[model samples]
Target: MSKRIAGPEIERLIQLLAKVPGLGPRSARRAALQLIKKKEQLLSPLAAAMAEAVDAVRICSNCGNVDTCDPCTVCTDPRRDGATIIVVEDVADLWALERAGAMNARYHVLGGTLSPLDGIGPDELNIKALIDRVAGGGVSELILAVNATVEGQTTAHYITDQLSGLEVRVTRLAHGVPVGGELDYLDEGTLSAALKSRTAF
Candidate 1:
């Protein structure tokens, strides 16, 4: 009879699990214990799903969204307003905007924002692709929905500069106070933007 297995295999699994975001050694240990308790119900299915996703998931060539299909559902959907495209940083942000159910326009995922310090420039991102999409015509407005970080703002400004000569309307998300922040702790940028965007106040 073969001797029982322990130590190395469990340690390897825990180490690999710890590499995932928000999961440290403690959480990985707990998760491994749970998986051991219900291997058939959780571990097997989880492994299968991860394998399937690895094989099937791909970035959409048109908009940079991740999907099993090439164009992704949003790009393939006919009802979405193709003439109005919302430019975002990543697929997660795109999904967040979609979940809001307020934006009727299509999307262009930039993959990431411009961060010169990090050596991520326009060429590294999907800025050229976005410009090409605009140049192809039929697009009436391009909404800059990148995050409020410094890199995000820089990327947005770069995009705005690129489309300056193009015959399309460009807009940005109105920056302002958070719904829950105390008025005294607000930053200068937020206060200025909020004041500039104020209406009938």
Candidate 2:
């Protein structure tokens, strides 16, 4: 067997890093070594940033978006359109939408989708908070930007049913083939959605 090379502290760091989403033990070890090699430039700054995030990270009470502030920058930003809100499945999705810069609307992070098998329900998500926000009025459109997965669609349907009595118009993010995607490579769902949502040139 290959003998353990790292000290206890370094080994611990690798183990912790391996637990990160896309990192594995080998990658973590490489990362740890790199961090140690560039301690002053990378390690110190990363550590400080992590510490600051740990101390300040919070969920926005109004929209469930994660940020350092209670209301979050998106919720409080005057530039965003208060009349339009995009409902997303996760904070990551919210960030993705923001990076796209397609619209200047606010967002509501659902936290997660409804999954009975996984013991996740409407109560577990930020659905109630979203309903309350919509109930407050002035929202002209509620865009459901959840994923096209089974759980995501189920959650979308449930939310649509819930808002049946509300006067606001609910919309969904259009799912179709990628800009340069070939029809042969697309799934049945994608093909169906693309055909249904086809627009005139």
Candidate 3:
């Protein structure tokens, strides 16, 4: 097949953009064209920002949160509850829980869940680091904010088992219907959990 293509540079940009999570070839092409058309306002600034991020962004050494700081702002924040830690499956989960603004505790990103079939085990996650933090003995409670999926539950169980001998208490998030969700729209699992966790009104 003859290589029917635009300029090599533009083609390369489109190809790279298409590899992004939510973008496809057509959308990437459109995006690239827009970027080119608005080079001064968008493309150049985006390029500079990408370069700056590449230089500055890093994984936090203490909690596995991605930040420019080695310990991350969350870990270093004195206002946060130093005796409480919320464990999550990923950085995205950490951000989500932060946005909820329910707790002012520190966080530990597990990096991923325990998926034996996919060959992702405890060793692949930040489980040991979490144990180390717990064992060091300042934290009084460790809240497992992992997802409700099988792998997420498995990971939470494993962590709880690891902290069994420690003085710190371990807790998991309560499962129930979402904030705006109706009872009729909920799944069997949600309904069951909501019933099991029912409280007196």
Candidate 4:
């Protein structure tokens, strides 16, 4: 067994930081040290910000986006194309799509994909809300921007099946080689998708 290195407060900070994604115990210790070193400049402000977020942040009732309001900024924005809704597996995916600045459209976060092995199903996701939104009319298209995993595809297909009789046109993101990726570096499936989805140069 290792000896205790820090006080309870510092040890707790490191423990909580370690719970965050991509941050291990060693990195958390370094982070805790940095925060201690910059207490007034970083630690105090971060604490205050977290406190504020604790009271202010909420899940959007309409689309599952996390924000300070019930409907979120994306759901309330009049400038976005409400006729098209891009469905994503998580808020992180929604943020990634927004960072790309490619589509000025609304979004629906499904919370997660269908994974029976993990006991995650359509009812566990925000799939019912999505169906309600589509059935309410005005939505003309649904762009499935989910991951390429089996669970993601299964979830997408389930959603499509649910909206079978709806007038909305359901589509999916194209699979192919990335913009700067080399052909030799890509796998057979990616190469085949690129060939099948070839566009005019």
The lDDT of each candidate is 0.91, 0.93, 0.93, 0.95
Stretches of candidate 4 above 4 Å error?
Answer: none
Best by TM-score: 4
Taking the tens digit of each residue's C-alpha lDDT, what string does model 3 give over 72-175? 99999989998999999899999999999999999999999999899998899999999999998899999999999988888888998898889998889988
Deviation of model 3 at 83, angstroms:
0.9
Q: For each of the candidates, give the backbone clash count.
A: 0, 0, 0, 0
**TM-score of candidate 2 relative to the true fold:** 0.96
Please give the range of 10 consecutive residues that has the lowest summed lDDT in model 3: 1-10
Residue 37 lDDT in candidate 1: 82
Tens digits of per-residue lDDT for model 2, 1-201? 078876889889998999998999889988999999999999999999999999999989999999999999999999889999999999999989889899999999998999999899889999998889899999999999999899999999999999989989999988888988999988998899999989998
Instruction: Compute each candidate's TM-score over C-alphas.
Output: 0.91, 0.96, 0.96, 0.96
Please list the Cα RMSD from the true structure of every candidate, rounded to 1 decimal place. Answer: 3.4, 1.2, 1.5, 1.1
lDDT of 4 by residue, 62-165 (tens): 99999999999999999999999999999999999999999999999999999999999889999999999999999999999999989999999999999999
- Flag regions of model 1 displaced more than 4 Å: 1-5
Give the total clashing residue pairs for model 2: 0
Which candidate should be chosen as best, given lDDT against the real structure?
4
